[model samples]
Target: MRPETEADLADMIASASGPICVRGGGTRGVHLDGAVLETGGLSGITLYEPGSLTLVARAGTPLAEIEAALDAEGQRLAFEPMDHRGLLGTSGAPTIGGVVSANVSGPRRVSVGACRDFMLGVRYVDGTGTLVKNGGRVMKNVTGYDLVKLMSGSWGTLGVLTEVSLKVLPKPETAAGVLIDGLSDVDAVQAMAKALGSPFEVSGAAHIPRGLNGQPVTMLRIEGFAGSVAYRADQIASLFGGMSVRVERDPETVAKGWAWVRDVDTFQGTEGDVWRVSCTPSDAAGLGAKMKLAALLYDWGGGLIWARVPEGTDLRTRLGAFDGHATLVRGAGQAKFQPEPAPVAALSRGLRARFDPKGILNTGLMG
Candidate 1:
């Protein structure tokens, strides 16, 4: 069921008997066996306000197109949403609706926020064939239930998003990186935490494991006007005095390095099951030490850990002791997401029932 308009989609859902799998470019790679509803036909940007740093676009609008439009205005989606095509091994086009539905964000998420933070508004069709609208085109348009936040990460189970409004930010004038060499995993995590606590406003931080590439490297990023960026870079380098410190001032080099960490570029080619684990930064050092048996990297100042474990490894059982959740981003594993607690699971089921009375939307995708 390909919908060219929201009305068309609502009518189709009104008549659907069996389950329906909603797709935005279909790059999510979650194999849902049911009638597929493609959203590519409902494309195009509806509005762009550079002065206000706001953007409204159809849900099916290509993410790349929105980025290009933002780039032209020296602005961007501050959350820095990631592109998962490489990791998922799928060639389907990525759409803005998909990014919002999945709540995808990149390295800078450590500083700014996730996709939900930037989502100001959304228009979707609930499972019972009801056209629902929540939020508005501006951040101050707060009037009712914050369903926009709820829909951001619902993965199209509660509703089918037809449009979205996001809060964008001006691009940084310049950027630089302070790279510390030869730090052990534990030491690297501490160093990143220190940098994040400083007044320089570190925008990105990650550690490349020594086991993976011979020498461990800790990277800290600062972005702003040229003078401020240079001053902060030097200040951060001075903070790491006596260590093997290198400042990357070249814009291209800085971008390339961060992009590598943001997209998990190195692991894209590795043949193994990849897991995205989120935990408190204080717990990251311990978790990394325990997971030393596998290939790993730390992002979000050690809060987000991306690990590549051997195939058929039961991650939930292996990581049951940890407080955070582990998501299987790749491989045909037993589960792709962490199981919710009993109470939370009950609430989720109840909410699904209210939004989708017939249970006709992406059944079992969350479990």
Candidate 2:
């Protein structure tokens, strides 16, 4: 089932007797045991204001289409949403709905925000077969409940989004990367935290073990005017004096490198279990140290750790105590999402019941 408009989506939802799998671009999702409802037919940009840095588009609009439109206006999605096809081994153009539904964000997320932060408004068809709208095109249009944030990262459990409004940012004049070589994971975490703490305005920070010439490479990114970028690069090098530092000014190469980290590219092609762990920057190294058998890629100045562990290894049990959580991005044995605590689990169930009394939308996708 594919909906071409809001009315069509509502009608389809109302008539459905059982659970339905919601698909957007079909790029990212777990397998579901229900009739598939594709959103690709509901596509196109509704509004774009380059001057205001706002864009409104139907949910099924291709992500590439939105990016091209923003690029033409010298603007971009500040969240730098990631493309999951590479890591998931799925072949489909990513869609705006999928980006929002998954709340995808790249390396720049540490600086700006995630997909939910940029989302201004949304129009979705709820499980009750009623059309619900929240927020608006402008930044200050939050008049009531912030349903925009709720729909995001909901995995289509609450509702099926039909359209979305987003806030964009102007592209930086230039970007430069400071590469510090030969730092161990512990030292790399400390260095990245220091760089992020300083006033140098580091926008992206990542460490790849055995990623560069068989040695650990710590990368710090800064974006701004050419002169500002040059000065910051030098200052960063001075701060980490003992290490080998190289500044990359080429935008293409710098983008490719960050994209690799953002999309978990290192874990690509290798057939192994991948886990994403989020914890305090100071504790990332300690947490990673426990996973001696896993390959690691650190992002967000050590706040986000991507691990390629052996299949069937239960991460939550192995890494006993931690400040944050670990999510199984791709694996066969363990559950995809961490189990929410009892209180939080109850709240989640309550929300799901309120929004989806029939529970006909993407049933069991979140579990």
Candidate 3:
């Protein structure tokens, strides 16, 4: 648990051996074992360029704390990664930098894009112990290579982020959700796709398995002013037709409900192995058809599916067969967050050459 000040970071980068997991309270400790870089020492907001709709903060700032500040100004870091401290059945603080580095996206990703979209700039200690920066506080800069987006999802293999600047948006004044209860996996995917194709401007849509479904819900959430959300939700309901619907006007209920779509908070106690697979929405059902798993949960409409497998069930070849990637999201790891190293994974090995040439930052993570 070595916490480094800015100067200390400069010194360590020059001499450190072994991969350093830049940890923020170990929110993701289960994912890997490497030398830890205790990023909390670097925590603090450096700048809030509200005029440009951007804010810069140290890497280890608590995401909850950042959101509270953003809320006060009616602004938010829009990608909205799921708070896994509670949902993953774990306990600890998660950092916003960690979220972006992980490239996590929640329900709003359907509308706003992932954390990669909002990230604008970064300062980090790279493999060579040199301080490197890319992008700027504003969105339009292209002074050099677009390293900001590259760093966003690099999983700290390239560098240990010291600071990050990102775009922010005004929080919507009101939001409403409508549930279309009792739809099968294929049907639920259809409804979500249909809703997005329409002009109702729906912000969130998801379907949970009926067995896993607490309330048998197929939910659609719309955000804006009271009048706008109310109007859009009504039109969406009309578009979907009467399927035993119930309106959720309660804001707190709406927030809590959408969270399930983010990270399967409701399915926490289910033990075994959980995985997050990225594929086309249509491939979601194929995942069920393919993998023999303990349980499965779908999020991101269907683009992201979470499956709980009996311990030691290999999802690699099965998931890779569907032409997508499966990451070990939780539970014990053969090697956490990593699937059994793929044959063509030398591509990742090659990437390490250009970024962390010395493999001094986070070696095995993306290697």
Q: TM-score for all predictions?
A: 0.98, 0.98, 0.92
Off-target runs (Cα >4 Å) in candidate 2 are none
Quote the RMSD, in angstroms, for model 2: 1.0
Give the lowest summed-lDDT range of ten residues in model 2. 24-33
> Candidate 3 clashing pairs?
none
As a whole number from 0 to 100, the lDDT of residue 109 in candidate 2 is 85
Give stretches of model 1 more than 4 Å off. 211-213
Q: What tens digits encode model 1's per-residue C-alpha lDDT throughout 58-122?
A: 99999999999999999988888888888777887889999999999999999998999998999
| lDDT per residue (tens digit) for residues 1-367 in model 2 | 9888899999999888999999988776467889999999989999999999999999999999999999999999999988888888888899999899989888998888899999999999999999999998888888999999999999899999999999999999989899999889999999998998889999999999888478899999999899999999889878988778898989788888998888988888888888999899999889999998899999999999999988899989989978898999888867788888889889999999999999888897666
Candidate numbers sorted by lDDT from highest down: 2, 1, 3
Which tens-of-lDDT digit does each residue in 1-367 have in candidate 3? 5555667886777777766666665666544566667787888887886667888899888888888888889998777788776546667788877887888778898888999888888988787778888988777887888888888888888777888888999998888898888877777888888887788777887776653435456778888898888888888888767577778888778888887667677657766777778888877877765775446666666777778788777787666556567787776645555443466577766666766787766656654
